[model samples]
Target chain A: MSGLTPREWLGLEATHNPHRWYLPVIPRLSVREIFLFGGAGLAAATTALEETTERPVVWATAQYLDFAKVGETMDLDVHVSVSGRYTTQARVIGRVGDREIITVNAALGRRELDLTETWPTPPDVRSPDACRPRGYDYDQDSLGKHLDQRFAPTTGKKLGGPTGHGPGRLCVWTKPPDGVGNSAATLAVFGDFVPMGISNVASQPVGSNSLDNTLRIIDVRPSEWYLLDIEAGGIANGFGHGQLRIWDDQGNLQAIASQSVVVRDRLKR
Target chain B: MSGLTPREWLGLEATHNPHRWYLPVIPRLSVREIFLFGGAGLAAATTALEETTERPVVWATAQYLDFAKVGETMDLDVHVSVSGRYTTQARVIGRVGDREIITVNAALGRRELDLTETWPTPPDVRSPDACRPRGYDYDQDSLGKHLDQRFAPTTGKKLGGPTGHGPGRLCVWTKPPDGVGNSAATLAVFGDFVPMGISNVASQPVGSNSLDNTLRIIDVRPSEWYLLDIEAGGIANGFGHGQLRIWDDQGNLQAIASQSVVVRDRLKR
Candidate 1:
């Protein structure tokens, strides 16, 4: 689409044995690539040597690595030590200009059993189309092209956006095209979505940088639409905490994410 | 301590369910206050609870219920339900301002014995007093006040008092001032130390805000000093990720902590 070959548009940071992948922190592609890579890895791991995918694969636990500029290529290789019965593990490397920008270790697994008694009831709320987007315009610097955010309520809406005097929850739909598979590529994609916990909610007109992002995939139910139920609270000084639960179309809880939040407005020394 | 005594600090939300707590958001506290509440709860959960606590209390997902403000005294309560052989579940509530500020469902567990394995080798490292702290000054906002962050570098230099950077791995000594015993109250205190995973490293000078903190009590080795080999990667687009494997002074892997990080600067934004 960018008038370049697949290899030219995005390069794979791959190598053999002691498998390795390298990706750049390009401003334009770094974040999206990481999500796609992570998500793809997980998808790849789940289905085995399955069919090549073309549809937008739905996945979760997308965290930001580093920013790749307008023209940097990222490399993603898989280090599958053990693709075990119930689970598997993969390590990722993201690089830019000889710098390994991000490295991730992700655990891949299939939905083996049902925890009906323990899990929370899915929120009986609005559809993705009903919710309006907020954080995208918070600050231009905080927004990314790769993220297609759709929130029913906009930033100015004082109430009903999840936190209004009501239930501080917001429903968000993030579309990272390459982040919906089970391969190392899938893991790389999903790992970049961790910031959506805030990006989809409070950070509009303001954005904060994250120090670390971690995701644990509880179940694997891949889909075309990745949904996030993001919420935040308990802000004392300036930092607080929040969580994101990713569900597929069937409304099954696929993965859950949590992170320490640094409210950008309060942290500017 | 107020005119209401325990009743003064007590208030339930409209969504309050006797079997479960639904918290409204607290608007007074800044982001920092939420962080303090989370850290305090971690310490309280880790050190206070006896048999019903999550082994390592790996923070799975922490969702902010509503807007929480500062200066208000927040009350947090935890109910342990079903302590399974491998998994333990708990209901947590955070309250303030005539409302429950937040509620969470936490799952604590030990490594499933179905897949027995070996812990990693203790890095050839130094003693706690050997390294300097890598983070910035500790204030009421940091988890450090609740922890004793003493480092002994086996491979890297002493961290430069909180904000400096070092190796991918390091060793440190941590202990809750009030020991976590075999009691429910103690579980509250045990989890406060899990955030040290990033503060001990010398990469970015960002304060930590935990979204969801999870820990697995490895051995529960009785000791005055614990060893933590913290490693984290997957830092893309400003968001990062990390994990820590804690060992008793005896080199036993006593616990494992993994957290998703939001990178806000020290003073907080």
Candidate 2:
């Protein structure tokens, strides 16, 4: 919050209380921005606690309760529940006045070990420049406009149709706004885009409101673009469940994320 | 806690306080039993709160902080963080005296909606009776003896060897001990077996200790065998991450579960 980098321009301002932070929901960062802040803001507060303990976060899960709208300011308060030699467990509560918006549980630690391998190999797809640039004409207010994305070769152009032709999966090359650098906070922001896969495989126009966004930080490497491989596992009884793997340009798996959302049929609405 | 069934024998004894429960780690319930208790105990406490609220739990996540050993009794305290018309957010802390073993955050609701579908089809495999019974002989003290399992045809007989020959996955028919019924609490207990796949595919003897177990409950049906389709996403930087889809005998998807674990090379140890 001090020397503002483009990434820090998430509008997260530190408060007098060291454990607390505030974020104002700006227009560009509003709609899907909730997912970004729901993850990034919570990660920011958790990261702040890391400064004192000097530990890196291994995992963080944000349970989203309510949505934050444009012009609304959200408050994030982090409390370290337990601190051990190698790990720290913390919880962050995000609120808008009396209403709670989100709650994040985080585990932080940095212990080096020899075991290392990524089982899922990145698909050999065309470079980002070769694919069509993804647009937000479907939802004019989509936060997709804030970031740049190129649909992967396997992806279809339609929003809602039959995706059963293949596994319920979608891949996209997502890049944060210019000047934003790759970091845990940025990865958390980018990992929440899996719900788009629900609509991608839907039979009609449907929107999903995520109940939780769980990000398991692996290793964030500096790169211009992040590859998000999303698999929508199931959609049943008004809810949709999915998992996403965030990979760096070098094909290093950075983080694993999963979520459950309340799916609403926009066309029926 | 009263008139207990085999499933109820999770050894979760209720206290005078309505919001509190205790778990005694017995022989059959030791080792991985702690994870079962960590999830089931929290679900028990959350379900108790449901008697008054009449809402079923939709999702629950347990973060493993410390180990609850044999001969030790753990306490589960449930705190309802927020209660809404269709949803309730709560947290349960499991502790042994001053030491916290696990923390669970749950979302409960009873909203009925028409949208229903499971994208992932149940694998076409041999029935439970046709497959060979799976057991654990490596660890004499293994809690696996308490339940019954049948290995899927696609799974290899070797526990720790290369598994890249097939899809990075494993399927098993898991059944709780006698008298245990198919309940959400039981499903919670059974959803934590993804680690078996690690050893199933590992080239060396490796043991995985889960850091977190997250279960997203869908629909529970009456069935003798629960199909666990586990996919080992990756093992990198000393950690292994995976997801499991729980299905009933009728091929109805019940829950989607995921976990992150710290892998230890037992042969080296």
Best-performing candidate as measured by TM-score: 2
> Worst lDDT window (10 residues) for model 2 chain B?
B156-165
Clashes (backbone N, CA, C under 3 Å), per candidate, total: 187, 1
All candidates' TM-scores? 0.41, 0.86
Query: Where does candidate 1 chain B have its weakest 10-residue lDDT segment?
Result: B1-10
Q: In candidate 2, what are the lDDT values of residues A20-109, reduced to their tens digit? A: 878777756656543334555554555565653567777777787777776788887878788876667777788889787888777777
- Give stretches of model 2 more than 4 Å off: A1-7, A15-18, A32-37, A137-142, A155-167, B1-7, B15-17, B32-46, B49-52, B138-143, B155-167
Which lDDT tens digits does candidate 1 get at residues B1-269?
01221111213222242333322223211233443345344433332232235254433333333334554555556666445555455555566655644444444544321212222456556566665644545343533443466665555445433322344444566653333322212223333333455544435455544444454343444666666666543332233345556666677655455554443445444
Candidate 2 at residue B240, lDDT?
Answer: 76
- Kindly report which residue pairs in candidate 2 clash with one another: B159-B199
